[model samples]
Target: MMTKSDDEFLDDIFGTAKAQPTLVPDDLMARVMADAQSALVKPDGAPKQSLFAGVFDIIGGWPSVGGLAMAGVAGLWFGVSPPAALSTWTAELIGVPVSVDLFGDTTAYFAETQIDG
Candidate 1:
């Protein structure tokens, strides 16, 4: 048995390959061109939104805005005055004593300094 060279193999494959011309209907070509043109062109007075506005649009718009606002307000409230139950639970979980003072010794030290001055 004789082995064929790489060039001979490729030549045999290409020798059987034939070039064929594809014919598309004129109306189909016209419609395709019209669609391509329409996609490339933008309509007049179309307002371009900023990145933030685009993100808000994708997140259900006004409802998402209201949700974000509510979350921020809730975070502010929790930071100012966290519930005693929450503080106690956290202290117990961390194996630490729950002090009655919210600001701890830092606030007391600052108050004493102000009084002395």
Candidate 2:
């Protein structure tokens, strides 16, 4: 007959405890999941929003809508009537001479000459 040493016997007992499967009741897990789902809240007790309404809320309600409208108007106004100094100011900032006229492009020529000198 073979016999296990004291250390081997202790190790076998502890190893079985480590390998044992823990059984949780199915109803307990269901109750836990339900509690978790209930804990994830919707703001102001409101029900779910439609897709468009959700997008509108994500874009920050009314103020962002007004700002977007104003930006569109400003872009249209600028495209129709550009300021005269816009050309000279852009020329100075870019370190080149530019004519406000778009008929014959020569800005690249001036830029190359200035860069070489």
Best by TM-score: 1
Candidate 2, residue 116: Cα displacement in angstroms equals: 41
Model 2, residue 10: C-alpha shift (Å): 53
Stretches of candidate 1 above 4 Å error? 1-45, 97-117
lDDT of 2 by residue, 1-117 (tens): 545687788899999999999999999999999999889786877677899998889999899999999999998987898677875776678978546777456888888899999
Which one wins on lDDT? 2
TM-score, candidate number 1: 0.40
The residue pairs that clash in candidate 1, if any, are none
lDDT accuracy of residue 37 in candidate 1: 82
